[model samples]
Target: MEILNSKEMIYSPTENREEKLSITGRVTFLSMVAGSVLALTNFISNSALAEDVIKIGTPLALTGGLADEGKKQQIAYDMWLRRVNAAGGINVGGKKMKVKLVAYDYQTDGKRAGQLTEKLITSDKVHFLAAPFGSGHTKITAGVAERHGVPIVASTASSLSVYNQGFKNIFGTLAPNTGMTEAMMKFFKKKLPGTQKVAVLGRDDVFPRAMAKSLSKGARNRGFDVVYDELYAVGTLDHASSLSKIKSEKPDWIYLTGYTQDLILLRKQMSDLGVTAPIVTMVTGPAYKEFVDGLGKLADGVTSSSWWHHATDYKSDDVFGSTKAFYTQFVKEQGHDPDYVHASAAAALIVLQKGIEKAGTLNRAKVRDAIASLDIVTFFGPIKFSPNGMNQVRDLPIIQVQKGKVSVLHPADIKNAEMQKM
Candidate 1:
């Protein structure tokens, strides 16, 4: 997918003596200052005039393991930008200003993400910032934004540990990692009464490890015995040894958490080792279409959890009117159904815009306060940020792949299907 460059450059009046400005641009600039000379001077000196445009800096992973996720996030950002621009931009302090994004491809490196975040804040001079793809990358980049006192909205970082750091400027869209297993455990206890043994496995990373720990606690709290729990090092692709050990315990439920590629490889190895569990739950991968495309029938009955889905009856005043509307437009544009990742990415930008509008000024502190106090419902879900800057309004939805289609299985209000045995 081609990334759209949403940044618009404003040229000085001295550059073109006879050129005419667009009606929208001229009107937007005139509303900023009283006289033409002062407007021209402000335009020449500060390219990102507060009256003209709201610039958001974003660092994306355009290469390496997270490249696919980065592309989907970029697409969501672009979609929001186009919709805001089409509506004559965001309304701020009684003036309309266009939105622009200053984005860079970080190549999926944490060090590069830190460097680019500094450059985006100090050199590019963006008003707000968007976090990188994953939890580890977001933690590194968010530190830079916090030090600079720039507000950053995180799209995908869901680990509780990420927000536990003392940073007032960072905010997240998704719920905490514990929500993933909390919902599944409640559903499993009711649906499958005899399921008591569970084996938990995860990658030795910030997000995956945190999720595994939460799952273990939630399982044990609900009277399920944890037969085996272990964490493998990152980049340890061969999981035959772990599968062999897990097979010996004969666990009724097997839960795995990791990145998309890691989960894909683990599922394949489980089949190769002839290790079968009545219930298998994987974090994040089964919610994405690529998981089904890669595993075919193997993805069937494999359950997962998500922060948002199109089956909800939620509505928003943003570009996408409702959950159904957003899903329709995303599928129309991308040629596939969007997962929670895409919805969360768009919701992050929407929350930022709402904060700026509520504050009615570009001041960082006021905007940050507005975000901290936000209590609005969005197409993605109800997005109310806790005092810790993590979303606490939405609950994770339990989903399973039935007949090669993603089916919502829990939360009786929006569930489209029931839990099925693997």
Candidate 2:
């Protein structure tokens, strides 16, 4: 804007030509001062507006083994970002600040993920962080965030060890592995009372290994005989030998834990070896549609437990309003339904958003305090962080894939069907 106006200049009637030049000199001096003030004011306004934005940085595994899961997380983050900005951004201390997401692909390397997380803090200067895909990656990155004093939310990491490290800056969305195991154990013991023998298998990675160990303990505690408990090498292309040993066990219940591809390949290999159990359970993989797409009929009668499902009849005044509302919009935009990974990813940002709003500033310490003290309900579930920073919501959903439809089979109240025998 033009700050100095020529029409506002004063003129003296008695001034001669020489005096007029002196009057012009005074006007020029005033103009310079006026211009200086105007420039200074504009600079201050621009800087304040720039500071009002919240930049959230994340290292995603957009390539290699974790690429697919990383994309699911990206979709959730993108959806939340659009909604928050569209609603005129978050109101922080009476000032509205828009959000910007800064992300880099970590290529499924834990070391690289840690390196990028440090870079996001030192170089990108992000106000917050969303951790990488699984517990293996989140653990590596969350430590870096803690040392730098940046608040990080992990959407998928549920292993107890992830948060037991005494790091205050790290928070997770999914409840601990025990919740998933306990829910499955209770439901199976009640329904399949005759179930005696159980076999377990999992990928030799952080989250999967942790889940397998927890599930095996829970099964043994529930009086089921746990046999053939083992973990395969990470990124293994073959599980034939493992499947053969499991088949030899003649177990009534077979429990497998791994990511999407690993589960799919294991299921296919199980079919090839003619290894079929009366009750087959897989952690997490059945919650995703890709598992069914990859295995087709092989996915049927596969029971699994997840931290969330869109069919949950929960509501919130937050971003998506309710589970049904989120499901409708996600299906409309992505042309497919969302899985637990998607819901958990979106919920993680919602937690971060609430922390920022409650603290009324992007100050890292303040936001971390607000998040740590939070105990609230969301569209996904009730979240109350344990003292250790992992979600304390224990109401996990147990599901089964039947004829291409993922159905809730346990917890009695929310159950849509009973377990089917193959």
Candidate 3:
């Protein structure tokens, strides 16, 4: 992943641009300041006090392989916080509380994320906790929050095991891998006809392993021949050997599941090895804009499933309205377009606000109960919690990257382009 520079702000105003104040000498300025001390002091004091405050803790992958996702999530969180504060904050038992986001970079390390979550709970004493960017990192931190009985909204964790852990304090914003892979299989069978042979490759992480298992099963159920299947460690930097094995089988399609860098390296090596055939469909490629930018022309013709795509052909305003607003603010703040990170973070914040409102109090237990019972109509659509704490909107659309832009190719409601052979 590419490293983003630290935040910067530029201010420019000439002397003549000053609106009203005109002080000729140092003594005049001092005398004028002393003359109207009461007004200035009262204004400053009241403005400071009028700012209500609520603390939020976030442990995200801000510096390592998942930095791209973390940066996007941070931008979304800040935007939501700004919007809430501008609207006079959230109503908690008839009192307003301004939201304050406190984020820590876990650098994509699970151990570091767990440690930071402990500090956030004990030292910072945040009012609420938001989950991290990566699934692996989120799992580690969820344990910490569960031990402390803190209510947490897990933003980007799509694995089913994340909810199966029986941690009542935790809730996932994204659909499970089983459901997502099912949607992908349905699209593949309808779109790619007479192509039965399939190959599945993924790193031996919780998310990829689960996805590969379910996706391979889905392919078989759809009458496709599961030619080859393999798993590697998350640290695998090269897939030449794996690709060589896959080429020997000459499967009709390749289903890759893993982190962004892992997928990029696999795609780059596949191109270099000259083993191009069948369609390569990944699970999380559309979640990051870098997936398109990194591969450039090589990304063309590659198709992947997306939970939230920017293209809006549906007549309903919910999808297009929310996506456009989110994209505009995300690009303005982070200088990039919206991705899964932005959508996940925005959904988490909306869910949190809804839960607090329903509970009528900010108590941890009350909030947890409220989250379990929430049926929210979010910017993404209706988000209802299942018995196991998963979102009811689990079906995702399959999209393809064509001509440097993403176009949906599934479920007719939003398929903008046809799927091409890779």
Candidate 4:
């Protein structure tokens, strides 16, 4: 027989006057009980540890066509995670639960994006999910998250089509392209007088297609002769044909709506073809240093409309401090300024953190309700979700690049510089 240790023995209650239980027998009994108790305690400890980890998954195109935008979002998200971690994680129901961010690169492929999202939700079991670059990528996760009952916030989906889907689990950070069109036209009317014969070129994707439609409608409505409008593929390399067509139309202004590569190539083609019309403007996402560097002097004087401008110094602006802080940290870490996509993603996290803090619980349903009903002010402005979960402040900033630097030129309250024609 094996000898047992002291902890293995225990005395039993007895009314027998003669004797007590045997030590060996007691030892065996105590050993079983101690083993059972240890097992139970370990199980409980593991359960607590699991509860402490809140998994957040993101599928971004870190490489490939949408690489530029995807990289920006990842940078912003890193800053967000760092800031939240630095502040001692999220306070959930009076207890601090550390955030765990799980990111995957979809390589700018739509199918791969969906595959990654499904794996994150089913295999990795992330608690929350973030939106990636394009509308198609966001739509894939929308269906997956809805089926799994996980709420998602789309960090870069700017298409109005996202809201039209009526998926309760998905919400986007950017305003609809329709709103941007109206705002852009209004700004042009105010800033540039006698701007007629407008030519618009857009990528044949959800965002640029919708934006181009709205821009064309607004231009025609405002009596600004819609001279030539064309839609090219998202990743189209040659803009020579489009430029030739627009040149033949003899438009006074050229309006472009597309992502980085298309914009950079088109600008170079425009300069190469000497298609200088004195009224060229693009709708956002290309006013960054990356775009300037990609196109060199070809990027000079190009005006673009954006949602955030770091130069604006508004005392009441909610995002000023946070934006500045993010830019400082981003430059230090990534050696560059956070672009619109990055800034938008950071702002999304800020709003989400506020909602989580207000709800005071880690319950998914409760957090979703809190986010839906949240009306808090954030770094951008007063952040109140509409019935469809869009931010109420849909105003965009019109920025002009002067001497390789971006400056806000519209919305008098936030305008820090005068407009310069490109």
Q: Positional deviation of 114 in candidate 2, in angstroms?
A: 1.5
Clashing pairs in 2: none
C-alpha lDDT score of every prediction, in listed order: 0.85, 0.85, 0.75, 0.72
Segments in model 3 whose C-alpha atoms lie over 4 Å from true places: 1-52, 312-321
For residues 145-233, write the lDDT of model 1, one tens digit per residue.
99999999999999877898989999999888787788788888889889999999989999889888999988888889999999999
Q: For model 4, what is the error of residue 161's alpha carbon versus the real structure, in angstroms, after optimal superposition? A: 0.7
Model 1 worst lDDT run, 10 consecutive residues:
1-10
Candidate 4 deviant stretches above 4 angstroms:
1-47, 313-321
Candidate 2 worst ten-residue window by lDDT: 1-10
Off by over 4 Å in 2: 1-48
| Model 1 Cα shift for residue 71 (angstroms) | 0.6
What is residue 70's positional error in candidate 1, in angstroms? 0.8
**For candidate 2, what is the lDDT?**
0.85
Candidate number with the higher TM-score (2 or 4)? 2
* C-alpha lDDT (0 to 100) for residue 249 of candidate 3: 91
**Model 3 per-residue lDDT tens digits across residues 1-422:** 11211121011121122223445566557545654464456446645753455667888778887787787788777777777888787788888887767677778887888888888788656778999876777788889999999888877887888888888888877877787778777777776676788999987988878888888888788778998888988688789999998988988888888877788888899899876666887767755677888899988878887667656422222222465676666677668667666777877888888888788787889999999998766666567787777787555777888888887887677678888888
Can you write out model 4's per-residue Cα lDDT over 1-422, one digit (the tens) per residue? 11111122111212121133235777657655665565556556646766886677788777887787887777777777776787678887788777777777788788877777888788656778888876778888777787787778877777767767777767667766676778777887777787888999988988778778788888999899998888988568798988998998888679988876678878888888878676788766455667888876677788878766665432322333554565667688887666667777877776666666778876667777888887755554456666676766567777877777777777787787887765
* Separate clash counts for every candidate: 0, 0, 0, 3
Off by over 4 Å in 1: 1-50
TM-score of each: 0.89, 0.87, 0.83, 0.83
